[model samples]
Target chain A: MSINLNRFNRVNRKKIFNRIERTHKTAIPQAPKRPPLLHPQLDISALTDIFLSKFSASSSTYQSIDCISLVPQLVLQYTELHNTNKTLVTNLQSLLTLDKSPLDWPDALTLSTPPATGEQALGLSYATTAIAETGSLVLCASKQNPTTVNFLTDHHIIILREQDIVPNIESMWKQLSLSAEHMPRAVNIITGPSRTADIEQTIQLGAHGPRSLHLLLLAGD
Target chain B: MVEHYKSNPQGSASNSTSGPHQTLFFKAQSSHALLDNTLQEALKKAKGGFIEKRSKAIADVENFESYKQQAQLVKNHTLDHLAYYLTQFEDNLIKNGGQVHWASTPEQLNNIILHICERRDAKSVIKGKSMISEEANLNAALEAAGIDVTETDLGEYIIQLAKEPPSHIIVPAIHKTRQQVEALFRNAHDLGDRELDTIAALVDEARLQLRQKFLNADIGITGANMLIADTGSAMLVTNEGNGDLTATLPKAHIVTASIEKVVPDLESASAILRVLARSATGQPITSYTSLLSGPRGIEDLDGPEEFHVILLDNQRSQMLGTPFEEMLKCIKCGACLNHCPIYSAVGGHAYGWVYPGPMGSVLTPLMTGLKQSSDLPNASTFCGRCEEVCPMGIPLPELLRQLRNKEHEEHLTPRKTRISLQSFMWTIQHPKIFYWLTQITRKVLTNTTLSQFFAKYIFTSWYNSKELPKNNSKGTFMEQYKKSSKQKKT
Candidate 1:
């Protein structure tokens, strides 16, 4: 539909335009100025421990499963600083074979793979916690590694840094604004595995996407 | 259509025995039996296709997150000033050569719609999938007044023929397997010896049947996803172009929508559009997202001659100043329902209302009255999955808890449960007495024979599917913590 752009006031329209421009220029603040990184050196093992602990406390019905065993490959980034341009295509191609070898699987699974194009793998960025309020994982998807990793894999494995966990949805917005320069293509706040109960009210997990989700938390890292 | 099913009475025997207030007790017993069957059947057939397709569609989009966030913000902003938006929407719609009707209750909405039907001398009306129309039971009302209304959405059409409410939001006939649907079609449509095994054939049959209704209808009725106050536009987002045709082909088009749908502009509408399709059907966008502003323009070729929007308040305006206002931000995406464990278990019909799932649980009581739906809030496992996936950020669990608190204050909880809680409170207040009572209970439970007997009779619900944890027979966790502290000091 063609909108009548002339109906809006020129001065008011300019103000809106100026605001948008200002927002674009100053969207992402420096890391230290933002919320402190809870566990700066959070790793896979520490994440697994926290996930098990949290899962145990929630329900007696849930069963614990090995998260790393489910992944295609564990890409341990030993970088001291954030790298936005590191591709993991060769590593992912090898990992896909390893991922297919597993026999028994968890009800939910997470996978990390390289972007379809030769873009840098969005390696697993850590959110402190998935918000209980909105089921959103507060991750800086701007880091190319994590962005590519989240989408390429059929299953998404997210490792949350314990200190980064926020209590509610409003805090997630706060964390996202902290780094504005490199907004990732997408920031998925998955609560559960992709599911649908459309067929006879029968919920089938992993219909078109990953049927499983595994959250690892690295605590005291 | 449901009246035809009512003739058997056996199917509705549970509902017939009780009034609306007592429906829960009947539902709880009958649905409890039905749930075991439904849940088992659901588990066997359950596979995650719908959500998977959605993820892939969303994964392809670069700006999907921004779209979701923008949509959520727009919905939040609109809901915050819903009263103002509704007024602006009503005013603008009237100004644009359309009529606006306000309905404070479902009864009023039904009467207003029927009055319009009567004035236009309408015999048949075509309808799109409208949860609000289901909420108002508009079809029954129209039918009771001797007007034939046909539901055109493929899923709704099947369920309408079966004379049952939709079991799921997006795929209304999701509960009916292909075999069950085949049986229903055979009986309803007189399809004798026709082997319709495939879903495509079934869809084609429905398409053929509904095409005539679309052309013959005197008026078309649909629900709006959002009503843009700035432009007097009513938006309908659908995978099929059925909504567009429903609104355009008839002489008069009537929209029935809750007041919360009004937004400020198209930019915000576009923002919401981003999330609505992805979260709902897992598509980048629905096949159709038609925005109709008043009737056909002077140069327009095909459109409704007369347009009407009936903004139903139906207790929504009452929520504006209250904490329940967050419920208004909902775009009816059904994401919460998809993620909800309780919804997946009992399905939508067991909730016994138009709206179902977590959102429905919160809304049914508020719109229907807390007295009628006291059990709705308590049905949740409080897994917090609904709140987690809700794009609009509705604090569902907190709302459910608040409803529980209201139920308690109103003495809506069962007397037995209240008495048990009261006794437990009394025991806790007296520490010495509580400790002694606990000691005796522990001693009794330590006896394997006694424990097994207690398991058999007292805690049947727990024993049915799961076993009780091995008790700390010696003492409680507090006692162990105290001993550990003493050891540390030493």
Candidate 2:
């Protein structure tokens, strides 16, 4: 079976290459340069504003914070408002490094970083980069930032530092390649909470992933 | 010849022997679809939403035309160097701890997947929306092997329960009414009068049911929107995060993609991304646009243990160096389907096969055979909405016209129609005879009694569905033209 499969692949590969080689010129055609994305030269403040506005256009909510310390308080407020459980799981290193002190956390709220199973209601992670053009958060998966945290939770909270905001997806890709050592297993660029229009074309949010997405935007670099 | 391929209700249940004869009998299928009140209601409800949303999304973009051009260029260039980019993609995916399997045909693709499943001892496989799998009838094969396969996407899950092929690419269950879905769910699930009254409730029910499947499934399969060769990542866009969950939660991950899906780098993928979501669903971007590279990293906390990508040629590689080569540039956004009058009127099922609508009409004949699906190319009204809306700028009408030419050349058209066309061609070659025939026919048509006699006898097929227009012209177009020119000269 393996040998037959190999022969099939080889025959196709040969046929395809020969066809393309015969048709294509000796000098390979270069990929055309893409025109610049929207507002390529916008300042950071303007970009953040655009990002937040576009993010709000989606069902997701956002808040501009002075620092990372304000995350837990907001999480508690969000949980209370929604009347969900007070349990929140996070893989954000800054929050973990802060370690529940100076950042006043309510005793009722439990916080821990474990691989998100179905039980986790809220999962917090940090975006490596955010695109202003589409209001998307780019999260790369690693040992620290598990891929499951992004999709497994019902309510996902993401931390986006102001400096991480890029003008467009192209810029975001450049920033990601420059920042990471190698491409992570999954680069999840999330734009909003999960939604579906499958049922008679009726748009419904929270199809299988997060019902709500909260972004705690850190104001400064 | 007409009887050689007939629509079999049991055709979709099997893979190997079941030909998609619905394509062959498209006229009958379309006429049948036209009268399906339930299907008509569903198609009516779906028709305007996609068009309105797509227009809004495109209007929001300042330079959408440039983006479309860039996307077209990227796909065209990639197709020209398909072998080069595919090799690069294979090499990079292997470097990223992912295995690449190549299959030249749909059977080979299915066998490769089954072999992988056998090796992994996978019992339950969760699949995201893969049109290629639908084309290969992978689920039927898996079930035949006694493996449990579940479609995780909401649309797919609904249709899977119905034991139907996808009516639309973006929304597989586009032809299914909500009440029909409710009935399907009530039958499929063992619920004691649970209320699935709202869309939200139905979605929640699917999530509740599929969650366990997500966690328990040994292998997950998904289709790639684009494959980045430089990074060895398969870019998947999903409004719901089912694709992400299906890819991440399972023990082994398999990406089902075509060879044309490969692009040179992340930037090219990004370029295509600009117009993909906007054209498909009228969103700036989907909720989750994941560039999944490989399986779990050595230091990663959680992901699939093994990653594999199955690249199916399936007559795609053969499309190269041909006029139909331009068809491979299609991104499967379904914009053409949304704007196509033929598609909106009859819906996708009438076209038959995995792909449907204008793009499907071009593709079904090419992938399947022109002889089998000869009617599909003629299904279009040549309104050209499909070409206008296609983001990749595929000349859908031209491709369909070419297919019609091929069908004509192959003598696949009906004998009576062929004779009429041959006579018409011979008459048109002689302008004087053609002019005289047209003048005599117009005079007869203007006379009500003669027109009625001709309509009943010679134009029976044309008159059956339509009425003769009220003619008010004094003379044939040539006579009028000659008279006006003569007066001007005098």
Q: Where does model 2 sit among the CAPRI classes?
A: medium
lDDT of 1 by residue, B261-335 (tens): 888765566567657867877754443445566665553434677888876655565565467777888888888
**Per-residue lDDT tens digits of candidate 2, residues B1-490?**
1212212212233335233446787888888998999999999999799999999998987778988988887887788677677777887888888888877667777888888888888899999999889889889889988999999999999999999899899999999988899899999887787898878889999999999999999999999999988888899999999999999998999999988899988888888998999999999999999998887877888899999998887667557777888889999999999998888989888887888899999888777777678899998999999999999999999888887777877789999889998999999999999999999988897999999998899989789767998786889999999999999999
Candidates 1 onward: DockQ, in order: 0.04, 0.54
Off by over 4 Å in 1: A1-221, B1-23, B26-39, B43-68, B437-448, B461-466, B470-475, B482-490
For candidate 2, the TM-score of chain A alone relative to the native chain A: 0.82
lDDT of 1: 0.60
TM-score of 2: 0.92
TM-score of chain A of each: 0.44, 0.82
Worst 10 residues of 1 chain B by lDDT: B1-10
lDDT, candidate 2, residue B151?
98
